[model samples]
Structure formats: structure tokens, C-alpha cells
Target chain A: MELLVASAIGVIMAAGVYLLLRARTLPVVLGLTLVTYAVNLFLFVTGRLTVDQAPVLNQGHESFADPLPQALVLTAIVISFGMTAVIVVMALKSYVESDSDHVDLDPQDDGEADS
Target chain B: MNHWIILPLLLPALVAPLIALAVRHDIVLQRIFSVSSTVILLVLGAILMGSTASDPVQSYHLGNWIAPFGIVLVLDRLSAMLLVLTAGLGLAVLLYAINGWDAEGRHFHPLFQFQLMGINGAFLTGDLFNLFVFFEVLLIASYGLMVHAGGAARMKAGVQYVTINLVGSGLFLIGVGLIYSVTGTLNMAHLATEVGRVDAADRALLEIGGLLLLLVFAVKAALVPVQFWLPGTYANAPPPVAALFAIMTKVGAYAIIRVYTLIFGDDAGASANLAGPWLLPAALVTMVIGMAGVLAARRLGEAVAFAVIGSMGTLLAAVSVFTQEAMAAALYYLLHSTIAGGALFLIVDLVNQRRTGYTDWLRAAPPFVHTGFIAALFLLGAMAMTGMPPLSGFIGKLLVLDGVRESSYAVWIWGLILGTSLLAIVGFARAGTTVFWKSAAVGGYLEPARPLAPALPFVAVGILLGASIVLTAFAGPVTVYLDTVAEQIYNPSGYIETVLPTSGHPEGVRP
Candidate 1:
């Protein structure tokens, strides 16, 4: 179980890094989403592997899954989605305003350079 | 009355859609929503503070499920104070928003009101997961607010800000997942107690998870290397919007304080596998660099951005030390800095209100009437930032430095307190001279350099200052309350029990 989760996380992170280097704003947002998936899973894995163990149940079994990480991840997923939406919208607005879809290195300084 | 606790969360959420849909057309309706919501928040904040001040461990278990299962809202004096500040600032910003709002029924007020829901919720939430929800709510509103005027510069900056923060959110999720995988609990109080039960050998996993969480906060807080997006985005944002964000940074600082104290709890030895020692030095360094950013910046708005960063540095530095005095000082100073810094930023926004001839510092210089008073206020706030005395700033500095001084690491305390203070003064005092005093060749006067007879906010600040001054005299008692806060946070069995069923108290405060 650990092997599967770890390998899956590695693959997700790799994909995230690849997309992250892309020049376009949309891809960067995509990259961020993918990376978050990897991260959420990775955090989950920290509690170690627990199969056939429900986090919600009776005692003396000496092994319930770590429920804390699961709870935290649920919140993370929802919040991350909200952030992704906000960024995507902002990027779209940027594209519309500046007529550019690619991320620019040097941000315009309110055009204060000339003044 | 018990259910009244959720009003802070509910009123904002309920009113937001109403404001967005029904009140979009009439400015009058917008004012009513904005004003009413702000007032409601203020009253709610005061009630929460008073109720929780002595008890200091108040919890509203949403659905009453108790810890290890249910979601909860916790209110304590520390969080109570911050809630008021957020509401107070929200009120002031909403008023400012009314005149500056571009069009009718644009849903701006609704978004602002919704944003408040997130902030106050974040402060009050007892569950770790809920913090993320609040953050997203606030972040979404901020994105709209950032690009409200639809300017190319802000839009560009907003895109970067969004990207950077999204990455941060991703990291945060990963951290949360890891912590759950290890701990099996999400309620902060429950986690605090259960966390201490883990084996020492397995501590590395928790440390890594803690670092990931810290990384997320570091980005949100805009600490050192992660702070590149702040100056660019903030500099371009409408002054009012940027001013609103002045308090936003404190959210990050507040999180660091909340999570750190809850999970790690005051230097628990090296074997405890805590996230403190590293954070302490790093926080100090963040401050030094933030001050440097202000010193290097050319423009006034950019300078303020770095100074904002500097304030974050101080707040986090106080948190990293994990001392009662330090924590209280961090809390007090953070509120003071946010309100004062936010007001100053608003004043700058007013400075750019586009009179026919007048402009920003770069475009032209304006006349000075009450400019001296404004300059003095900035100086006072800045002086407090430096830990200079008599004012609340001095009091805060004394508290923080005293905390570190009491600890064994004397050199670390001195280096951080003295060095950071010196750099902060350099950053603020220089900006004070240039922005307010050096009235240069420009077109004409813009908005109030200082209001003719002191506007509502100015008077409001005078009251805030007076309260803070009173705080200095009451520092000893407040310190005792803060000590209780630190104690309650560091050891949360009581909190966990309150959230849990009465049977849960059978273990009887085990940590």
C-alpha cells in the first residue's frame, strides 16, 4: 500500500514540475493543481499505510487509520479548488486586459518608469 | 444564545448573496449592507471577547460532535481581539469602498462582506480543516478586489499572486494529508494532546509535515524568499484594496501563531521534534530582509509594501520564539500594525484620488496643511514598530523582548530585538520623511494629506491609540491573560474535552 501511494505521489509531482515550467498562464495553473494532488496524497501517506482500518470505529483494535490527516486533506481539497478557480479567473482577466496569455517576467510598474 | 456564536459566520454569509443580488443597484442599499454587517461584526466581536476573556476556552461545537469527530469554533481573548480588528477594518474599508466602487450592483459589497465571513471564520474556527475554507473564501474575494478597477497592472500582478498562492494551497493540502495519515485527528485540541503521545523515533514524519505546513504559511505570510509577488501586486492594487490587504497579512501571522502554539507548544526540547528553533532564526532573518526590501525600493507604494513585509517579519518572529510574552506582543503588535498600516495605506489611496491636477508622489507633489499630523501618526506607528516606548508600540516591544530575555538564548534575543528594531526604524522613518515631508514639484493638492478636522477613521484611530495606551498600564494583567492563552493553547485537553462528550473527560487532562 505504501509502495503504491508513494509511486503515485512521485508521478503526480513529476507531472506537476513539468507543467510548472511551461510559459503560459493556464499551464502554470494546471501545474499547480497537479502538484497539490501529489502534496495532499503525500501528507496522507505520512500517517503510514493502514489497510482494512477505518478511522471511524471502536477501540482495542489498536489500529485505526490516522484520522487527522484525512480530515485536514478534505479541507485542503476544497480550499485548493477555490484557489485554483480564483487564479484561473485572474489569469483570464490578465489575458483580456493585457492581450497576453503567457506569463511575463517583468511586471509593468503602473507605467511609473517614464514619469 | 449559545447559537449566537455562529452569527459572526452566518450573518456575513447570508448577507453576502443578498448584497450581491438585491442590493447591487442602489448605493444606498450597498451602504446599508456594508454598515450593518460591519456593526454586527463589531458587536459580535465584543461579545465573543467578553464571554471568552475569563473563560479563555470557549468552544461552539458545530453540531456538538466533540473532538476526534466534529467540527468546532473556538473563541479566546487573543482571537477575539483580532476578530474586532478585522471587523473594524472591514467597516472602515466598506465605507471607503462605497465612494470608490466603480459601478452599481457590481456585487462589490457582497464580495467584501463575504470576505469578512472568511476572515472572522478563520480566526474563530477550532478545527484545522475549517481554516482552509476561510482562507479560500477570503482569497477569492481578494482576487476580485485586486482587479476591481480592471487595470492591466493589477490584473497582471493578481495573476502572479494567484499562482503563487495556489502553489501554497497545494503544499498546504499535502501537509494536512500527511498529518492526518500520521495523527488520525483534525480537531486542533485533539491533535495537540494526541500528538504528544507519538513515539520519538517516528517524530521525523511529523516534523516534515510540520515544515510543509510552515512552508504554506511562509508563502501566505510572504516570508523572505517567498515574498516576491507581494510588492508587485500590492503596489498596483487600488489603494483601498491594498489597504484592506494590510490586515490580510495578519491572517497568515495569526495562523502561524494559532497552529504553532496548538501543535508544537513552546520549545518542547529537541527530541520533541518541534518546528520552533528553525523558525525563530528564520523569522528574524525574514524581518531583516523585509526591512532591506523597503530600504531598496524606489517608489512610495513599493516602500510601503516592503514595510508591510517587515511587520509580518516582526509578528512571525514573535511567534517563532514560543514564549507567552512574545505571543502576546505578537498579537498586540500585529493588531496595531495592521490597523495603523492599513490606515496609512488608505491615506495614500486618498492621496491618489485623481484631482484634476494632483497625482501620486511620482506624478507630482501636493500641498501640506495637516500633513504634519499625518506624518506624526506614521512616525508614531513606525516608532512602535521599532519598539520605541510610551505608545503601544513601545509596550509591545517591551513584552516581546522581555520574553526572549527570560529565555536562555540571550544573544538570539538581543540580536533579533535590537537588529530588527534598527532596520525597521530605518525603513519607516525614511519613508515618513520622503512621502509626507518632502513636498516636491507636482500639479496641485489631492485628498487629505491630513483631514481638515480629522475624519471618522482618524478619530477612530485616536480611540484605538487611547485604548492601546490603556493597555500599556494594564499590561501586567493582560500578560497574565496571555499567559493563560499560551497555556491553554500549548495544552488543549480542556478544549478537546469541551468539544467532546462529557465522557471524553474521563482521561482528565493528560498532557
Candidate 2:
């Protein structure tokens, strides 16, 4: 189980990095989403992998899984969701305004400089 | 249990939503409420600073819950000082914005309030995850403000800024997770004690987590190798928004000081001073590159952006020494640079608003109506930024230099700082001559196509510059207070004791 989770995180992060390096805005947005997924998974695993164990106290049970990481991961998920939404809208706005999807602004297109 | 400790965070949080919901369409009402709240915040901040001066540390636990379990807001000399600075800057920027900058976009008042809430929260929170939450709050609000005046340049800069910060936030979460997995606590006070007790086998993981966290802060601080996003973002932002952002980099510096000394100080076993060796060299390189950017900048706003970067490098280099005196100097420099950098941004906008052609570009264009007054303001701002005498910048640099004189890197520090000051002076001189002096020499001066900017904005900038002068005039008492703040930071026992009274067993320890 541990090996599976680690490999999954690695694969997701690799994909995220590859997409993040792309010059297009949409790919970059997608890349951030992928990286956030990896991060959320990593945060979840911080409580350690436990099967059939309650996060809450159970009578007659010697141990239960730590619950703090679960709460943290949940909060992180919601925050990342909001962030992803904001970035997507921003990318769309930039694309519509500039008529280009490339992430870097062309020097000539800088309005203040040209003005 | 002081309830007032949470006021800084609460006032803005509550006021923001009220402005968004209740007075969204009423610009007059929004302005009235926003300005009043900011004034109240400044007064509260002053009171907090005065109270914390003698007491040194105060903690407020949420909902009567104990430390390490419930959310905690800890106010010390450091947080109080920053709170007051933020409120002062926010008021100045908000007042300036009311001169029609807020009308450029929707929800300006609410977003401004939200940004303040995030900044205050980040400064006051005692937990790592809470800090992350506040960072998101600020970043989101900043995204709205950056593109508030919606132009192609702003949208492009906003996209890049958001993407880079998202990645940094990811790293922050991973680092916090790893630390929590090992130490089982996110409360900074508890982490301070628990980090020292980590087992030898887990020390490597702990170090990796700590360094990763530092990397996160380095990105925020615009430290070298991770600072590419700052110039574009700052230059593209609206002047008033950019002025508020002058404190944002200092937030990163504040976090570095707070976390490094509290949790990863000289006593954190193998993680002791993990960032110490690398910080100074990186800071020097940051200084050199930032000054280079300033010299190469083609526009006045871009030059101010690079100057901000340069100031950060200087401040961080002093902090890297990790001595109490050096920390005091760093704090003093931090306060001075924020005000000066903020004033410079506002002055650039004022210049941009007045020019008939090639606005804000470092070229010989026709002079505006208030050329002499604007020129003098720019000169004083530039002098302060470049560390000239009779301004706070010189005093800050002297204090930092004096503090680091005993360190092994003293020679390098002195050399780089002095050389950079010379470069900054030359850059500002060239810019000033091109923009102001040579412009008057141009024949056939044309009347400005636009009316002159209101005197209110100039008054706002003057207030900021006046504050810097006051900082210089009161350098003795201010430095003494910062000395005590630095002392409290270096010795975290008082902080920990206030946050967590029981040392051996924290309140929220899970069996």
C-alpha cells in the first residue's frame, strides 16, 4: 500500500511538472491542478496508511489513525479548488483580451511601453 | 485571553463581507466604511504596539480552547509593529484609491479589505496551516486587485503570478505535511519544542521539510533564482495596489524570521540554522541582480519594482546573520524600505498621470504643471531608497552594517551594500535627469492632454514620505523597541510559554 501511494504521487507530480513547463496558459492551468492533486494526496498520507481503522477513538482498540492530516487535506482540497477556479478565469480573460494563449507577454504588446 | 488580540483579523474580515454584500453598489458608502475601518485599525494597531511594548507577548485562544488544539492568535512586538505598518500603508493606499482608482473596477473596497484581513491574519496566526489559509486569502484578493483595471498587460502578469504562487502553495502544503507527519504538531510554539526532540533517524526528514518551507518563503520574498515573477507583476499592477504590495515581500521576511528563530533556531538539533549558510550568499546575489534590473529598467515603475527587490536582498542579508542585534537592524531596515518603496510607487503613478506623452517612460518628454514639486518628491524618495544621508534608508543601512560588522561575511556585506548603493544612486540620477531635467530642456512643450492628478494623491504620497522621515527622526526609540522585539524573537521561551504553559505535555497531545 505504501509503495502504491508513493508511486502514484510520483507519477502525478511528473505529469504536473511536464505540463507546467509548457508555454501555453491552458496547459499551465492544467498543470497546476495536477500538482495540487499530488499535494493533496501527499497530505492525506501524512497520517500514515491505515486500513479498517477508525479515525476516532474506539473502545477495545489499541490504536486508531491520526485524524489531523485528514482534516488538513480536506481543507487544502477546498482551497485548491477555489484557486483553480480563479486561475482558469484569469487565463480565459487574458486569452480573450490578447488573442493569444501564450503565457509570456510579447514586449511589443506591453501597452505602457508602447504608449 | 485578551480579546482585543483578534481584532486586527476580525475587523477586516467582517467589514469586507459587509462592503461586498451590503454596500456593493454604493461607492460613497463603501468608501466611507472602508476608510473608517482602516482608521480604526490603525488606532487599534497603535494601541497594540504600545501595550505589547512592555508586556512583550500576548496570546488569544479561540473559543476558550487551549493551545496546540484550537486556533491561536499570538501578538508580540513583531506582529504589532507589522500590524501597525500594514494599517498605515493600507490607509494611505485606500485614500489614494478613492481619488478614482477604485472606480476602475468592481468590488475594490471589499477586495482591499480582504487583502488586509489576510495580511493581518498571516502576521498573527500561530499555526502553519492557518498561515497557508491566510496566504491564499491574500493571493486571491491580490489577483482581483492586480487585474482590477483590466488591461492586457495586467491579465498577462496576473496569470503568471497566480500560476507561480499556486506552485509555491503546493510546496508549502507538502512541506507542512512532512513536518506534521514527523512532529505531529502544526502549532508553531509546539513545533518549536517538538522539533528539538525529534529522533535521530527522522532528523533528515525534518531538515528536508524545514528547507522546503524556506524555499516556499524564498519564492514569496522574491529571493534569487525564484524572483523572476516579481518585476513583471509589480510593474503591471495598479500603483495604489502596488504600494500595498510593498508590505507583501516583508510578509515573507517576517515569516522567515518568525519560523526560523522560533522552531528551527540554534537549538533545533540537526536542523539548527539550516538556512543560515545559504541565505547570506543568496541575499548578496539577489542584491546584485536587483540593482542590475534597476539600472536596466526603461520605465519609472519598473525601476521602483527592482528597487524593492534590492531592498529585500539587503534586509535578508542582515537577517541571515541570525544575531539579535542583526535581527533588530533587519526589522528597522524592513520598516524603512516598505515605506520608501511604497512612496516611490505612488510617485511614479503621479508622474504617469501628469505626462503628456510617453507616460512614465524614462525619456525627455514635455514637463507637467507640478514638475518642481513632483521632482522634489521623487528626489527625496530616490534618496531614501538609495540610502542617502538624512533619510531613514541611510540609518537603516548603517544599523544593519553595524550589526553585521562582527560576522565573517562583514567585508562582503559592506562591499556589496556600498557598491549597490552607488549603483542605485546612478540609476536614479539617470532616470531623474531623463524624466524631469532633460524634459524641461525640450522645446515646444505641450499642455498635458489630461488634467493634473488631484492633490489628494500627492498628499497621500507625502504622508508616506513623512512617515519615513518620522521613522528617521525617532530612530533611537524605534531601534530600542525593535531591539526588544528582536530579543523576544531570539529567545522563544517567552513565546512558547505564553502559547503553551505546560511544557512536557501540550494540551492537544493525542495518545
Candidate 3:
């Protein structure tokens, strides 16, 4: 179970990082979303993997999962969800405004870079 | 629980939603509420700073829960000082904005208020997770503000800015998780106690987490390697918003100081002094890179933005030394740079607004309207930024130099700091000559020969520059106060005991 969760996080994070380095906005947005997922999962497992254990109090349960990480994960998910939405909207705006999805300004348009 | 401690956060939190929902259509009402709230915040911040000055550390437990299990807001001298600075800077920028910049976008007032709330909350919160949440609050609000008066260039830069921060936030969560998994508490005060108890085997994990968190803060502080996003974001952001953002990097610097001093300070056993080795070198490089960018910058705004990065470099280098005197010096530099950088940004915008076609592009255009006044403001700003005599910048640099004089890296610190100041002067001088002096030889005034901009913008810029002068004039008393603040920071036993009373310690983690 640990290996499964750990590998999943590693693979997703690796892919997210690769996509993040791309030159366009859409992939970067997708990359950010992917990284958020990996982070949420990583945060979730910080409590140590406890299967069949509840996060809440219940009768006769001998042990329980640490609920704090779950709470932390929920917050992370919401923030990342909202942020992804924001970046998507922003990416769409950039696409419409610049007529291109490239992440940087056109070489000549940025005066500081050229000079 | 003195409720006044929480008012700085609550004032902005309440007013932002009110402005957003009720006064959405009424820009006049929105400005009135926003400015009044900010003024109230400044007053509240002053009161809080005064209250904390001679007193012991204070903590506010949300929902009346005790420390380890519940979220907390801790108030010491450092947070109080930052709260005041944020409010003052926010008010100045808002004043400049209402002079015409706010009307260019929707919800500018509410977003500005939210930004303030986030900044204040970040300063005050004592929990690691809460800090992350407040960071998201500020970054999200900043995203909206970054593209507020949206242009293609602005939106593009906004995209890059949002993406980078999103990744930084991810790293922050990972760091927090790693730390929490090892220590089983997110309360910074509690973490300080728990970090000392970690086993040798788990020490590696804790260190990784610490360094990861440093990377995140370094990103915010715009330390080298992660410093790339700042120039684009600041140069493209609306000038007033950029000015307000002068406090934003300090948030990162503040976090670094807080976490390093409180959690990972001299008492953290194996994790002690974790940041110093890494932070010092990165900061030196950040200074060099920033000043070089200043020299290379073709636009006035970009040059100022690079100067901000350089200032952060200096501020964080002082912080990295981790002595009471150096920390105090860093705090002084922090105040000076925030005001000076902010004043410079406002002046850049004034130049941008008045010029006809040249729009802050550091070219020899005809003399723009009010060239003399803006030129004079730029001269003072340049003098302040380049560490010349009498202004707070020179005093700040000198204090930092003196503060770090005993360190083994003193030679490198002095060489880099002095070298970069020279670079900054040349950069600012060139831009100043081209934009202000060279315009004299161009024969004619800018076309259409516009009259002066509104007095409010000058007033806003004047207030900031005046603050710098005050900082310079009162350097003695201010440093005296900050020295105590620094003393409190390095010796954080007061902070921990206040946040976690003896009974407040929860059970240790099962791991």
C-alpha cells in the first residue's frame, strides 16, 4: 500500500514538473493542476497509511487515522481547485488577448529583454 | 484576550466583502470604505505595535481553543511592525489608485482589501497551515490585481506569475506535510518544541522539510534561482499595486525570519541554524543578479523592480546571519526598502502617466508634464535606492554592514553590498539622465502638452517619500526599537511559552 501511494505521487509529480516547463500556458495550467493533485495525496498520507481505520470516532474502533492531514488535504484541494479555475480563466484570457498561448511576451514586445 | 490584536485582520476581512457585495457599483463608497479601513488599520497597527513593545508575547486562540490543538495568532514586535508597514503602504497605494488607477478594473477596492487581510493574517498567524492559507489568499488576490487593468502584456505576465506561485504553493504544502508527519503538530511554537525531540533517523526528513520550506520562502523573497518571476510581475502590474506589493516580498522575508528564529533556531538540536549556510550564498547571488538586471533594464519600471529584488537580497542576507544585531539591522533595512521601493514605483507610474508616447521606456522623449517635480522625486528616490547619504537606504546598508561585520563572510558581504550599491547608482543615474535630463536637449515638450496630473498622486508619492525621510531622521529611535524586536526574535522563549502554556502541550505522535 505504501509503495503504491508513494509511486503514484512520484509519477504524478514528475509529470507535473515536466509539463510545467513547457513553453505554453495551457500545459502549464494542466501541470499546476496535476501537481496540486500530487500534493493533496502527499498531504493525505502524512498521517501514515492506516487502512480500515476511521478518521472519526466510532464505537469499538481500536485505532483511527490522524484526521488533521485529512483536514489539511481538504483545504489544499479547495485552494488548488479554486486556483486551477483562476489560472484556466487567466490562461484563456491570455489566449484571447495575445492571440497566442505562449507563456512569455513576444521578444520585441518586451523592451527590457532586448536591450 | 485583547481583541485589538485581531482587528488588523478583521478590519480588512469585513470591509472587503462589504465592498464586494454591497458597494459593488459605487466606486465612491468603495474608495471611502477602503481608505477608511486602511487608515483605521494603520492606527490599529500603531496601537498594537506600542502595546507589544514593552509587553510579553501575546497569542489569540481562535474558537477559544488552547494552543497545540487549535489555530493561533501570535503577536510579538516583529509581526506588529509588519502589520503597520503593510497598512501604511496599502493606504498610500490606494490613494494613488483612486487618483485614476482603480477605475480601470472591477473589484479593485475589494481585492486590495483582501490583499491587506492576507498580508496582515500571514504576519499574525502562528500556525504553519494557516500561513499557507493566508499566502493563498494574498496570491489569489494578487492574481486578480496583477491583471486588474488588464493588457495583453499584463495578462501574460499574470499567467506566468500565477503559475509559478501555484507551484510554490504546492511545494509549501509538501514541506508542511513533511514537517507535520515528523512532528505531528502544525503550530509553529509547538513544532519548535517537537523538532528537538526527533530521532536521528528522522532527522534527514526534517531537514529536507526545512529546506523545502526555505525554498518556498526564497521564492517569495525573490532570492536567486527562484527570483525570475518578480521583474515581469512588478513591471507589468499596475504601478500602485506594484507599490503595495513592496510589502509582499517582506512577507517572505518575515516568514524566513520567524520560522528560522523560532522553530529552527539555536535550540533545535540537529536542525539548528539550518538556513544560514544556504541562505547567505543565495542572498549574495540574488543581490548581484538583481543589480545587474537594474543596469540592463531599459524601462524605468523594470529598473525599479530589479532594485526591489536587490533590496530583498540585502534584507535576507542580514536575516541569514541570525544574530540579534544583524536581525535588527535587517528589520531596519526592511522598513527603509519597502518605503523607498514603494516610492520609486509610484514615481515610475507618475512618469508613465505624464509622458506622451515614451511611457516609462527610459528614452529621451520631450519633457513630459511636471517634469521638474517628478524629476526631483526621482532624484530622491534614486538617492534612496542607491544607498547615498542621509536617506534611510544608506543607513540601512551601513547597519547591515555593521551588523554582519563579525561574520566569516563579512568580506564577501561587504564587497557584494558595496559593489551592488555602485551598480544600482549607475543604473538609476543612467535612467534618470535619459528620461529627465536628456529630455532637455530634445527641443520640444511632449505632444498635446498635457497639464499636471491630479495632486493626489503627488500627495501619495510625497507621503511615501516623506515616510522615508522620517525613517532617516528618526533612525536612532527606530533602530533602538528594532534592536529590541531583534532581541525578542532571537530569544523566542517568550513566544513559545505564551503560545503554549505548560498545560497546552498535547500528547506526542505515535510514530
Candidate with maximal lDDT? 3
Question: What digit string (tens of lDDT, one per residue) describes model 3 on residues A1-115?
Answer: 8999999999999999999999998888888988999999999999999887876756687678888899999999999999999999999998999999999876644333121
Evaluated on chain B only, what are the TM-scores of all the candidate structures, in order? 0.88, 0.98, 0.98
lDDT string, candidate 1, B377-398, tens digits: 6666555555677766677766
The Cα error of candidate 2 at residue B71, in Å, is: 0.8
Candidate numbers sorted by DockQ from highest down: 2, 3, 1
Better of 2 and 3 by lDDT: 3
Model 1 chain B is weakest, by summed lDDT over 10 consecutive residues, at: B355-364
Q: Which of candidates 1 and 2 reaches a greater DockQ?
A: 2
Deviation (Å) of B178 in candidate 3: 0.3
**Candidate 2, superposed: residue stretches over 4 Å from native:** A58-60, A109-115, B507-511
lDDT of 3 by residue, B4-63 (tens): 888888889999999999999989999999999999999999999989966758899988
User: TM-score per candidate, in order?
Assistant: 0.87, 0.98, 0.98
Per-residue lDDT of B480 in model 1: 74
Number of the candidate with higher lDDT, 1 or 2? 2
